[model samples]
Target: MITNPSTSQLVRSVSTELRAKVLPELTDPALLVEVEMMLSMLDMAAVRADHEIAWMMQEADGIDTALSEAAVEGELPAPVRDALHALQLSRPADLTYPEVQRHYGLASEALARAADQAHAGDERLRSLAWSLLEGRVDHELATIGAYVAVGRSENQT
Candidate 1:
């Protein structure tokens, strides 16, 4: 979500490949299918990430109440206690809506990469990608997966 240098680099690399090499090589109609699949995956990832962010934000808001209630009522389940502790440990900014929006931006870039890469000179992949990119893809579709790979560069501390 923070868009570390590594994530930025990966997106840049994929974008360069899509524009410089992938697009030009796409001629076969079969590639469209791959494109479509990629789009579906992208959309799914974006949607899921969006949902998760929303849920997390909502959960964050309720943390104080939950923790207070748990302290008064009794001990909480291990997971609930862990979640509460983690929530307390996280900075307010980290759980803010802006952070979620940044994550959504990353999701979009990831989807774009998948769509672009679906062009393997196959008509299906091209068509798939095109249709999905153009909004022809179905509502009930797969997700555009995120690369958590940027985590390595994150300063968790």
Candidate 2:
């Protein structure tokens, strides 16, 4: 059995070759900017290929935790009650991307539905959900890594 080069390696290899071989001979400003955009997309693709699944799984886990806590609270708000009912349904049997994506969607929806209730244990669950959302923002920031439009007027320096 042979292992394949990772998406990051493949994309970086192509980008590097293009930078070394192609960029040197290119004189068109428009084309140079376009190539830069393409390189940025390739970089993003590499990062997503490496980390998207793990991030999704982590978010799903956090959402499930919140839902589980919300489910047990007495006199639950309608959103929490509905989310708890929705969550009681079984998740997908397979753990493929599409299946996991579907599972994440359902769980995320459940958590969003219960985001506003601030009574009793509901407040704790909402707080947990807020923390999870903050973590999600952190993950996204890590993924995008302080992106700024490179060719923008403000970026001209």
lDDT of 1 by residue, 1-157 (tens): 3365443355445545564666456565456445434534444544554455554444344433434454466654344455445545554456566775554343343334434445544343344346434431322232334433221325111
Per-candidate local distance difference test: 0.45, 0.71
Best by TM-score: 2
Candidate 2 shows a clash count of: 0
Model 1 has an lDDT value of 0.45
RMSD of 2: 4.0
lDDT of 2 by residue, 1-157 (tens): 2157987778778888887888777677677677767877877777877887778778877777666765565455677667656655747668677877877787777767666664345666667667767888887887777686855657332
For candidate 2, list the clashing residue pairs, or say none.
Answer: none
Off by over 4 Å in 2: 1-3, 73-75, 88-90, 116-126, 146-148, 152-157
